[model samples]
Target: MENRTPIPDLIRLATTTADVDTLLQMMETFCHHFSYPFDRPLRQQLIRQMLENPSLGSLWLVVDENRPVGYVVLTYGFALEFGGKTALVDELFIEEGHRGGGKGRTVLQQIQQTADELGVSVILLQTEKYNPRAKRLYESIGFVDQERSTLMWKRPN
Candidate 1:
């Protein structure tokens, strides 16, 4: 008889400088896939800062079979509109081959559980309009379209 047991998905928080390399690799892969601009040095700095400061946010590695296959970033914030603590899913990416098999949704469920544990009132994320697949996934997971305000950003020179 052959034994079969389902492999449990793991979400491990990157809590030290040691994990930065894997996180960076995942980030680079994600950026390349989406054609998003990336500055390696600044990205490393930001990851380090987040690791050092719990209040800023968290970086997590999604592992299966002891190998990191993806990563997710959650940045914390305070908002009166949300009525308390809130978080933004800054980035979520599952490596090319590992996607489309429920990994992304599993990671999101883990994030929501963590948010509940931390008293986070809301979890927000954005996806490119051109990517209907992503938008559909988000919608399926209960994230509604925000019709009120357009998200705008300004960078200080």
Candidate 2:
């Protein structure tokens, strides 16, 4: 079919506010279906804030077939253990149609490459155990669980 490609076509690039509205809608739908969170206003505001901050890291997006397939947003932070600014992959989501297609691994590898180029000491992320498929993907990419740190968040009031 015309829709099918002989080669896997995926691209990752920086994101801008022009992409926030659509990304928020996608994130909202993803959260709701997965019993996650869906607050469009907050997502919009978060994206805006990240866009305005140079230290907030970059949004390396995943696109396939000319449409956004997913995104990886990483922020940098100084870690005493690492002794430098490390990257934390705060968000990574693939569109429903692209799931199980093995594109996650490809995108993740791309990010790792970028991290190395940036001289990042670490790349970290969190995911639920219920998401075994995702867990496996991370494992294959050499991500081991950090036994020392536990993430806690206080969402804004």
Weakest lDDT window of 10 consecutive positions for candidate 2: 4-13
Which stretches of candidate 2 lie above 4 Å from their native place? 1-9, 153-157
Give the total clashing residue pairs for model 1. Answer: 0
Candidate 1's C-alpha runs over 4 A off are 1-9
Task: State every prediction's TM-score relative to the real structure.
Answer: 0.91, 0.82
Enumerate residue pairs that collide in model 2.
none
lDDT of 2 by residue, 6-37 (tens): 43546555566656765776777678778987
Cα distance off (Å), candidate 2, residue 87: 1.3
Per-residue C-alpha lDDT of model 1 across residues 36-66, encoded as one tens digit per residue: 9988999999998898897899899998887
The ten-residue window of minimal lDDT in model 1 covers 4-13
lDDT score of residue 70 within candidate 2: 77
